[model samples]
Target chain A: MKTVKNESSKGSPRPAHVLQKSRLWLMYPPRLITTPVVWQLGQKHKVITNVRQASVTDEIGIVCLELEGRRADIKAAIRWMTNLGISVEPVEINIIES
Target chain B: MDKNTGFMKALKCRECGREYPLEATHVCEFDFGPLEVVYDYDRIKHSLTRAVIKSRPQSMWRYRELLPVAGEPTVGCQVGYTPLVKADRLAKRLGIRELWVKNDTVNYPTLSFKDRVVSVALSRARELGFSTVACASTGNLANSVAANAAAAGLKAYVFIPSDLEQGKVVNSLVYGAHVIGIRGHYDEVNRLCAEIAGKYGWAFVNVNMRPYYAEGSKSMGFEILEQLGWTVPQHTVVCMASGSLLTKIHKSYQEFMKLGIVAESRYKVHGAQATGCSPISTAQKAGLDFFKPVKPNTIAKSLAIGTPADGFYALKVMKETGGAAEDVTDDEVREGIKLLAETEGIFAETAGGVTVGVAKKLIASGHIPQDASAVLCITGNGLKTLDAIAGHVGQTREIKPSLREFEALLDKENKLINA
Candidate 1:
């Protein structure tokens, strides 16, 4: 039997120094729902984009995604996505500690 | 030895009924439907007798046959079996006949109902060969996860919004868990945790291990019935955040009736929410099938889930059970907390306050009758959320050490000169 992977479970060193992977939810307005922002994100930056879940309607669109790249490149891509009218937010916000 | 010996049938899709192995997967790969735990009732009915359950320890494990865990629970063994107090004074204040309070404020360790779910989730996480457990929590859930995971000796990572209550943050940090503060709303933290779960193979109690985790909530319902002489209450008012607890309690009642634990009777499960972030309650009131997510703006931080994952199921339960949903303003939440404290001597958190406050409205609007027996779910303690009602509860009065000074003060406030 193959062994189960537990590298991350072993309290591995933080990944914040080099490569970074982030899960983001992007909400698109009606006008931008049809636009290819996710496609352009890959073309414009050195990032790997994977769509985890998406819901599209006539008025609004929401997409849950996984983005992997260098920390600086990922930051640039997120800023670009925000400038293009897509609301970019990180995942797993169960606690509102304000 | 066949490792899976329990009566658990399989994990079936809620929408399509497609079966999958009892693994950590929560959604169907084919249809993306949420997977629900299924059990063989015939086998459970034969063994899960009242005497058997009564003979076990008083912790949530007493209902282990109903829970989804396979092996003996290795974590949070002391959780559950909280007091279910009969609130006569609270009932009189609300102009109702009989009222009960399922007080989970005194729940073990973290002192909230979340301990029940975390206990089950961490146990299943260990059984599934995972060494790390994580969650994206509002506040109570983070505290429970941190405390339980510490006792279980598992690596824990808790993510929360940067603006959570100081008490809740301290509760988690005191348990020595790795706490990460995200500079966003709870929904954003939830999304990030989901992504992290996908990339890293840690067991996120509410995300990846959700099917088992949610089953823990049924214990609350079971205890509610068991404590009430094995009878269902006419109405059960629950505080809703992600709406899972309400739906699970409804399921628990149904499960008990199905297993011959209680005589079947008509019962309604009402959901309560704070108005600032009431997606489910708003949808239910508008008679809509879906809820629109909102940016949360409430002092009841624990109940600030804008996009409740189980909102649809919760709405369905409310409709099918002839129940109504209501939301309370932040001011009403404080008032509700004070009402419970003064009348029942139970200091409940804002979520509990929301439950009490919404129950008050439901009674006034004739949704819940004044004479009908009801149970208001007090999910968390007021001490964790003191900031919400700090300036509102009233200031303390100073009295001198002498009876002469006290008499003068009393006479000044209420003149005794006539006497």
Candidate 2:
């Protein structure tokens, strides 16, 4: 619900939720598309539910996600991605826990 | 002159395939996906031919059938047909066979390849009933828009990052464009340009006028194939910032194949980027289905897009064509500039260096075959990005103009030359 700049067990990754939207800006020189990487990551994280991709431009692409898992596990999976040199940003959804 | 009607059907959404009237916008109203210029291959096949095209003047105009501009071109008609130099010496240094350089460094008027796109945009702007051409750019686009607009006798408005290189700023100012220096990164400046385009009727070339503008890039692919004995390359490497060039080249290859001109699509594309500004490449390597946004930090300022507009499509092409994207370091970029100059005698800017540097990396990693015919696109002239190599390009030897002064440094000079 709130952005806290903290990591998982290593105090490097903050909490990440399932069914929340996030983004990653990668620097891989071999490609400019993000779908392949997202598909590849979904294979690793058991909580991943769905991934949809949209083109940003000829030089950019965006991915929308619906993940289902523990917040810590999802955050750890995201940090694992960062360790791969693929930058990811977690965009929080406005929660109304009525 | 024959009628070239293949390019005027309508602009189609790359994602949804929804068509729109021939206009300047690059995105669709729904789903936020980008739009690309669509052509009727059946008409082009009937209209354009190699003998016919070869008979025409040597420029990007040779493929006029595929371009969006209507009627005779009036401004910067000397555009296109940049040289494709064989980099044998550079090839030997990199241990690759059959490497060529598609040099847009000497692009007319302004020194960058942006001239090619801007000329097309201006021509179509005139045809589409617009009198003003504008854009928000970091550097090259500003120069091209201003120069082409001035040549076309139209008013110009160019927006750029406030801290852009003086050389680029001066280049645009000299062309008499109404220059605006926004205090922000290229992304922020680009956002402002989008807002301005919505409010004002000014034809922002990269924003609203992109369909026609992007058609200009197809010439790069056309030239590469035509110059290479009417065959496509085994691999083509282009530096990626906004990812337009990479996708357009892919489209060009497709067009050629569809027209029965290329016979088949065998070209592999490699994208080059600075590590600090390599969002697409990072996504590609991380094996993601979509890109993660980046905060750019790189010496290849020409290609420092933190959020590339076509990054998604560029990635898609890489997958579809068995291509790869890679990033290089700032030091490697400088070395790449020196290497290209020393071996190929092509003193390209930082972005070109990124292509060369990343090409070397891809080659070493066995991504590109040793014997594959590869073309490294040098899109901009070194003069435009002078600041990138100002203190490092050529060695400055202080000496008097005399025989004794000449003889005084003979040993050092000889060793340097021979070494």
Best by lDDT: 1
Listed for every candidate in order, the interface RMSD values in angstroms are: 4.9, 16.5
Candidate 2 stretches greater than 4 Å from native: A1-98, B1-6, B185-187, B412-419
- Candidate 1 at residue B89, lDDT? 93
Once fitted onto the true fold, the runs of candidate 1 whose alpha carbons sit more than 4 angstroms away are A1-98, B163-165, B184-188, B413-419
Choose the strongest candidate by DockQ. 1
DockQ of 2: 0.03
Give each model's clash number.
20, 60
What are the per-residue Cα lDDT tens digits for candidate 2 across B1-419?
22433346788887778888776566665543557777666777887888889899987888888888657776779997888999999898888988999999888878778888888888888877788877877678888888888888999988777886676789889988999888963433443455455446667677667778877888899999999888989999999987889988888888888887877857788889989889889998977656766777887888877667677788999998899889999888988888998997888889999999999999899899787779998888776676777776667688888888878799778999999
Question: Could you tell me the lDDT of residue B337 within candidate 1?
Answer: 94
Model 2 global lDDT (CA atoms, 0 to 1): 0.74
**Candidate 2, TM-score vs. the true structure?**
0.80
| lDDT tens readout by residue for model 1, B46-136 | 8798899899999998988888877788999999999999999999889889999999999998889999999998988888899988887
* lDDT of every model, 2 decimals: 0.83, 0.74
